[model samples]
Structures are given as structure tokens and as C-alpha cells.
Target: MATTNQNGGNRRPRGGRIRAGSSRRAQSEQTELHLLRTATWLFSERGFHGTGIRDIADAAGVAVSAMYYYASSKDELLEAVMRRTLDVLVSSGEETLRDVADPAERLAAVIASHVAFHARNPRAAKVADHEFHALTGQVRQDILQQRDAYETVWSSILSAGVHDGTFKDRGTVARLALLQMTTGVAHWYRPHGELKIPQLCERFAEMGLALMGASREGRALEACDVNLPDTQLLLRRAELTIEPREKPTGL
Candidate 1:
């Protein structure tokens, strides 16, 4: 009961109905994405407590009643944003580490990726870092588990480097310190400033290596290729846009 359409695809009975269904699904997806992007920006600018469901719906240009179709509550939206940020971080970190053999090189690559991500998507990074305690119950636990998984990646790399005599055995202390140092980049990095992402990556990688006591062997890390996704492309993929805000005075 199917016939070939112009594109050689099978056309079934009630094809108009099928097309309409598909269109509605696509529109629904677009609306949810718009809500998520708007929520991410709002939550980043105003703390989660300060941003309400109505705020997100209004900013997304959706009726307040329609938001419940996508998310049960504002907490659900925050959880979605947090999960999305972690998913990107974990997947990107894993991809970056693939085929990178040397311990120092691995550490450098991670530092590069971390610094680049924070610098490029500062708003999302800020939300991920600052809004942890805002989530409650199982949602908070789930986010914590995800966060630990990402931290384990760094800890494993540091452990390997230390075992191989490339880095100091500072253990958990080193891992926490390195993450704090790199994540802080999201707070002050300016796109129009003198430091390009690549240079910033290199600088951060060098600092990370030094922090791990690999300074003597870190010369090679400085030259390691720091490949990362383009910032604009990443923002586009996430359906998010970040407008420039007034720069804070002083360092």
C-alpha cells in the first residue's frame, strides 16, 4: 500500500497525516531547545533561585502553561541544563584523550580542553560550577556522580603521570587544585582580549604541568597540539547565544 515519492522514498497511506505529525514533533523539539537555551542564559546571569519558570517561558517566547509539556518544573529544567553541560564535558574529555599515549601529553590535552571549554562557554561553565547545591534529592546525586566521573578522568591521568615519574604524587590535592585553577578561567576570560583560545590553552597547560611538578619535562607539553571545537560552532550546536556583558573593573 506504499508508492514511490519523487525522492524515491516510500509514501504510505495518510501521508499528509504522517507529514503533519513529523512537523509537529520537529516544532516541539525546537520549542524545548529554545526553552533550554533561554533557561541556561537566565540561570547563568541570575542564580537559579532568582530565575523562575515564568521567566524562562517569557524569555523563550512560549506560553507559561506550555512549559509543563516540556518540563515538570524549573528544577527539571536546571537538571536538564546541568546534565547537558556534563554530557558535553565528559564526551569531549573522553574524545580528547583518545589515542593520546604519554601521561604528560594526556594531562596537557585535558588542560587544553578544560580551559578552552570554560573560556568559550563561560556562561554554561559558570552555571555548572556554581549551581551544584541548588539541585536536590536524586537530581543532585546524579549530577554529583557525573561530576565525580569527570574528576576521575583527571585523577587517573595525574596518577599515571606520578607513577611514571613525570609528575609529583600530590594525589587528590593536586587534582582538586588543578580543576579549581582551570575552572576559574570562565570567570574572567574575554573573547576580544589579547589572548586567543590556543594561547590560553597552552598557558593553562603549562601552568597545570608546573602545578603537577612536571615543569622540567613540560617543554614538550607547551608544544603539544591543543585541538578544540570552535566556540561559535559549539554555541550554535547547543542552541545557545551569549551576549557581551560589561567587564568587571580591576583584576
Candidate 2:
């Protein structure tokens, strides 16, 4: 059901006890993630235009008024879903800030982290990138900002690698194309249905690296065409290559 834009994750509290310093605002965000995940499933199944506030409230097991407290309209709920999706991708970046000193390894972590996160939460992933145009006003701008920020993560990583000798990309086109190829992973990933996240991530990372740095092993990965159980990745890449990038129907 995920188109190409939305991304996602479900946040569950840990150990039956809130963290020692978890603040009230943090708890509120957790509640919103719960509501957003529920709405994502409903929206993906019913389509955003087909869903209603009462439907989301019922699906989330919350009062309609409670849903209204966080999102006044369906558009606002859509924005919430986008923010939640971006939050996951950004969170994965934060994990490597200090631990990953090498640019190549850091970028590898970024790709692996992204593919893994999207594979874990397909509905939210789809809603964030695919269903976000259904927003209005400042909310739409805010979602765009989050999305641009996510892209910047890729842009910055490539730029950094280019500065050093660890990686190489000819231009922004090549850089973006490589990143989009990885993003395409989410559009077709299925854990139980076919390939595992690690397999997809590792394989795609190899291709991205090979395209950029021409890593010897990566080149082999690119040439290795063992058929996967599901032809999702090949099919997705083929569709993306042919499909024109359409302008969004902005709300």
C-alpha cells in the first residue's frame, strides 16, 4: 500500500517502566506514534481519501476527541504520520554520529539502517513518502522540510565521502540516483514474504558502493544476478526507471 514517499515505525514503551528522565513531551510523542501507526494501517488499506476521523479513532482504540487533540483534521493526521516516519530515519543517523568515524562505514550504516527501518514498518514508510501530498498550509511545508532534511542526510554523506578518498560520485545526479535506489528498497521490501532486511540492505549497499566507488567486491555484487524469491527489487527498479516523477497533488 505504501507508494514511494511515506516511511514508518511503531514506538512501544520499554520494560513496563518509563525511562528515568523521560519527560512529559516525550511521552506525548510516544502516544502520537501509537495513533499514527494505527492511522497508517487504516489509510493504506482504505486510502487517505476514503478514511475518516472516527475510523482512525476506532482503529487506534481512542476516543474521537482524543484523536482531535493531536490532529484536527485528516490532513493533520497525515502530517503526523510523515513526521513520525522521518523521525525514525533521523534517529538511525543519530546512532552513528560518534560511533562511526569512517565515512564508508558510516554511509553503510545509513543505508543498512534505512532499509532495516523501512522493512520493519512498511505502512508508515509508505505513508510518509507516498501519501504526504494530502497536507495543507504550514503542515505541508513542515513535511517537505523533514523530507528535504532526510535527503540532506544522503547528500551530506556523499559529499563527505567525495571530500575524502573513501568514495566517489560523479555528480548530484549519480549521488541521488544511488540514494533513490536504496530508498526503493522500502517500496518493495517484505520480511516474511521474501528477502530479509539484512540480505536486501547488504546487497543494495554493495550496488550503491560499486556504482560510486567501484569497490571490487561491490562490482561483483552488482554482477551477481541470482534470482531472489521475490522479484520485487528488480521490478521496482524497472518501474522507477520508467515512471515519470509526477508533481504532487498538493492540498
Best by lDDT: 1
Off by over 4 Å in 2: 1-34, 58-66, 215-251
For candidate 1, the 10 contiguous residues with the lowest summed lDDT are: 242-251
| lDDT to native, each model | 0.73, 0.59
Please write out the lDDT profile of model 1 over residues 114-178, one tens digit for every residue.
Answer: 88778877887898999998999977888899899899999999998888888888878999999
lDDT of 1 at 21: 42
Candidate 2 whole-model C-alpha lDDT, 0 to 1:
0.59
